[model samples]
Target: MLFDLHEAAANRVSTTQRRNTTTGASAASAMASSLTASRANGLGGLDTAFTSTEDLNCKENLEQDLGDDNSNDLLLSCPHFRNEIGGEYERNVSFSRASAGSPGGSECRLAEPALSTYRTNASISVLEVPKEQQRTQSRPRQYSIEHVDLGARYYQDYFVGKEHASYFGVDEKLGPVAVSIKREKLEDHKDHGPQYQYRIIFRTHELITLRGSILEDATPTAMKHGTGRGLPLKDALEYVIPELNIHCLRLALNTPKVTEQLLKLDEQGLSRKHKVGILYCRAGQSSEEEMYNNEEAGPAFEEFLSLLGEKVCLRGFTKYAAQLDVKTDSTGTHSLYTTYQDYEIMFHVSTLLPYTPNNRQQLLRKRHIGNDIVTIIFQEPGALPFTPKNIRSHFQHVFIIVRAHNPCTDNVCYRQLLSGQTLPCPHCVPEHVPSHCSSHWRNDLLMWLLPH
Candidate 1:
């Protein structure tokens, strides 16, 4: 079969050369005749007989040399023959190869000419591959729950419940103050890190009053009332506490003045000087526009504040409703204030700074943020990841980083939520102090505060 194919291919090539020579000779003869014609008359008697005779001789020679049995093989083996034969022969050849149940098998066995011709001449159309099939890459699997280190199960596991509250000591004014600690798992923090809502309760029975009962009877009663005139007992008793180290907690409890100041601040509210700074890092165009127009951060920023502020029961409430108090100005220097458990927190937002035409650093903004003891850094999605080294502040000992997670339905988020894994790439901070780190799905945001 191979020998016959080769012989047929050679004959077809010779026939093509002869046909070209004959056509050239016919063109030469026609040109000679037209040139020799009379100047008065155009070459109306141009001879096409030579071309017709050469074509007929070429076809007869091809038929005689290449029989019907080898004609198909010659067409298949020679690309020149296939081109001359027309697209119909190419389509039939492709169909035969495809029907053989192995499209690649014919390609492997064919010579270079046959393969090249098959590719160039084949009219086979293919539908585009679906997007799902094109996507071969997948995200890495998240860490398993067993690999996560959730802190000590709960805060209660650290010490006995209210039973051993006497170990802390008695308050001079409140008298025999009892301390109780309770831990609550923050819904958002469950997947990100070890962040829990901790509450410290201080109870004293020395101030409670009883009707027509002895002082001893009142002494044995539950410590519900307070003798202090300023803040109510119930209000002062249970205080929502941040994630603090054991040493810090010990220092606060041992020092009577610190405890007193904490209670007073909780009652009277924090002063303007004692405010949490709101710094903007890599704020995208959308957030910058919002800030320029309304002197307020974008939805991601508002969502972050809602986590710390009072939760209101309302449908489709604005970001400001029952949340942060905004003091807007024409100069873009707006002030944000919010109360957490009656404790005032004034936020110095960076975006609210006076517009500086050429100042990219915004020194004025940094100065305010730098002086603040605690600062919250709001970062927009797709922006550069924020790091503590980006800012130089002597007094800013604590940094609360809030990152917006756009398109929260990503596989990484789902896998992390399922496996209870920490962030894939956690931000690095120098002089690292472990604090509560959490992810809020409400606005698709991740937040973590580090205190040095």
Candidate 2:
């Protein structure tokens, strides 16, 4: 199962992660070499060379109640999209055809145990643009690598696209907020002795940490987590914010059908098994070679907002899954987390939807799954697919189809990049697409979505 240098580079894992420390800097160097070679051969998707064009046209203060949260202003608009936030739509929903020939298809294992308190999606709306890039022409994409005096490095990749997925946790003070991965930096923190902070940096540049007692390996023997007061981070943010950044709302207006579906998903209610959308972690590097070798170095791209895709096997798409234990209560609270690699990848329920391709053939081409390029499916929990299924399909049936990406909102981030507002990866977008998806896309996904 040999992969191309470009594809492999497009999905590179973190070389500096402490877990990889055993392999040391040499392995990192090898990865760099591979990335360099791949870039030379041409392959920088979202990670390398990708930048947001919206930054140039957008204004500075997007959260100042300019006009309306759903404002249709060119520069300032609502960013709230209509994905999986609707109520449960199990009303006779079933797949048109059974998994008669679906290769990766399997029985439905997801079942709702109880929901004393749960969140379909966050309802908050706050996004702002950066001032520096407003005055100048678009600049080259780059990363912020800060070197502290403590012989440690804190690097944040800035050149990524639409934050399709997000991490969430509860704050002792602010209740709950979005979280960003701190990576394996146990020794870097001087005050806290080897602890990871699930923190969210708002558009206001406020770093809020969702406080909770940390547990290791999330073992069966670990102490139970305490249920705190008020709404969980996701709900709290949703409660405070009334609308999406106006930018997203305007984009949704243009795509009424998808917007309608998003509203439907939301009304139906969102769950791990029946999510309306899926997130991808784009993997690549920002290098001149990457820029030169790749034609998609520009910002129009939005797919795979890089993180750790290798860590995502086929959870919703296949029998292989990552366990996400959920516990909710009537006190407007819920807790969800997944234990992986001797650590828990915690999460708060939210909403998402991705139309990676307008048509099936295009999807195959983008993933390089054609004749010479065979996309091998591994049952391993961490070996996820390039394009994953949004919801868990049951043995009897499943419903819903892919929603086309909204061009108006695809490349643009909710706010400014510096404000921690990331854009969605908009790759595989048709240069001159029709007003909506073509007939082939809707006729039936069985041809492409299901295995032969």
Candidate 3:
């Protein structure tokens, strides 16, 4: 429900600008009209891989109107459009053709196909048009690597090349966070007998990389681990990225589908279940609120954060964390806590409250949000032994839960602290406690954004 069109437009993604392969509406329309008629026949051995409503309709329509005769001419024109080492896709391709020539002597033409020409199902019939017959239709299609729908295979190839996406006429900024794909290793599946494992690295951070194996078939190990629907490496990259991008688009448009999908991913074991300190600032938060559930829907939380400005801030939880009112009485831990490097330690959530002497007119405690807690089990499996030094290493990640002996009755006392005046407690402590402040935080959309 959160993924409706309206919300998607609202969360518009305006990344760094780059050249895009703009499509003409007329060409797309013509292509779609041609394909839909063939849908009945093309249904055999065809995989309807394009899931979105708009793409399916356009592609299907184009497939129908494709004339068997012109189909060969289309392929002969854009030999480079082939899906295989040979001219497979080009042979069956359908798109508007335009004239093109080689650098010095000969001629080369390619089709600048529109999404309307985007077809599905790999095996398509190709009728060879004679060289002389193809001469009249000599207008070659313009060649360009398409950005949005290059398919996962080409995308990986492009990534490995480090060529700007202009090689595909796509916005370079919109490309994957990872810059290149290293060599891939294939291991024989226990049952299926072959699968590829790849190591991918990001452009900005070489040290940071993702390594995962793509399974050819569900083995006993795979079924137990739950990749039943796991796609191949290229396909996984191809599939998950586009889906996430769509989720992003929908988010900008104002849909909460991204949130829903993230939760679902965790539930399906596609993503890790740990909160990683990134959480949604939920609805109905007040001084009395506690027990934060990251998966729960909180529409108002977005509104609150949006109003605060799109900027983010990240700060260590240590000093401010000491201000919360956390519980140690319970042996139970919140399921949200998962071991993250350096942040893993047996620790109780630290909360804070301002203590005021009877004589101090200023309040000692201020409730910025609520006194929520983040408790760590400290004894999870394979965890390092807890030490004060080791625990200190994770202090930066601890979420602060500030409570108070007495809530500030008015802004008069709070304003004094914000104004740079030391409103000291009657006990001689400073009234204004420094809360967390940072230029960027966990909620930043580019890196990774969670609700809070």
Candidate 4:
């Protein structure tokens, strides 16, 4: 969206200038000369001038109407247009003509034959007819590319599903981040039949690449590094990493329908009974606000948690992550603690504050959304050992919650730290606390930084 149309225009003009300088005459002149010569003779000879005014007018009109056709012809003729094999022009022509059917077969024959007869028999001066057609033909075919739309494919499938968005803690000054997917290994599967690997590329920190392999694991194994991470036997890998999770998050957000669907799912409610918890900054927040269920909209999310206590499964609980109160830029607020449970599996949702009352209610529709507690059971059949590291790794499967204030607060904070700054959110900084400068800080100091 930031691309400049003017710059694109300038680039096209400059490219044209370069081509003209290298090839001697501009494309317009070459086309004009070819057309003029074709008209004067029988389109096969050097010059024998057509004298009839009607013939001249028809020739000029044909040239004007075939403006892009003339450019195409000229480009085909140019030696520079030839590919390494020297057959590109012919191939292109073949491709073009294959798609271009005759207007109406025999009934819609071109007027070339009648014009030819008029030229051969009449004696009216060529200059007597209008010069408008010739002048117009001599001008550029500036709007030609619109005839065959390119890059329209990228915008086509965008209307289908929910869009999932993930924020990579990035600096605003680094420009917009671009994402792309790369697939590696085309070979057939060896022991397990066949397998493929995909790497998602993001333009963060100049270039940060994450690769993930889909083997027998329900969750794919991820490698958070460059493509240099070599592939090995699927069994040899211990656990799948979280890199692929981020890739999935970003890609989902890119699709509008996907995002809508994910949000809709939260509103519709999941099949499983919901358990809830609420974690919010209490700095600027007043105690008058008690976590409650909306009577009009069924029981409150917190009530569901107490109702489903042991009936569900609290497989494990994690200390609520604590951080300085970001909204007030103060250290008075308590950090939120989160508990992990398994009604079915472990599901994590880290989100920004929901804005409107409706939006907040929609978020509260799910137990995990209300109480930051995840309760999705691992779907794999076999029971296995679970550790802190495994839980952390699986936590990468996160769904986004909209931030009420800043959508990119976390990303902004991450970039500031990467750039050697450890300040709190700028908007929330209070007047009383001493300004925490970026420099002259101990590396070991645990500075409370905020993510938007």
User: Model 4 — TM-score against the truth?
Assistant: 0.15
Tens-place lDDT per residue, model 3, 198-287, is 333221111112222233333223343233333333433443233223222211122344334322322232222222222232222211
**Which stretches of candidate 3 lie above 4 Å from their native place?**
1-176, 189-195, 199-352, 357-363, 367-452
Q: What is the lDDT of residue 254 in candidate 3?
A: 22
Report backbone clashes per prediction. 0, 50, 53, 38
**Candidate with the greatest lDDT versus the true structure:** 1
Better of 2 and 4 by lDDT: 4
User: The CA-based lDDT of model 2 is what?
Assistant: 0.22
Per-residue lDDT of 371 in model 1: 65
lDDT for each of the candidates?
0.33, 0.22, 0.24, 0.25
For 122-227, candidate 2 gives per-residue lDDT tens digits of 1121122234423432211110111111110111121123222233344323232332221122233465344322223222112211222122213232332222
Q: Best to worst by lDDT, what's the order?
A: 1, 4, 3, 2
**In model 1, which regions exceed 4 Å deviation?**
1-274, 283-333, 407-452
lDDT of 1: 0.33
For each of the candidates, the C-alpha root-mean-square deviation to the true structure, in angstroms, is: 36.9, 27.5, 29.9, 33.0
Query: What TM-score goes with each of the models?
Result: 0.27, 0.15, 0.19, 0.15
> Which residue window of length 10 is worst by lDDT in model 1?
412-421
Q: What local lDDT score does residue 394 receive in model 4, on the 0 to 100 scale?
A: 17
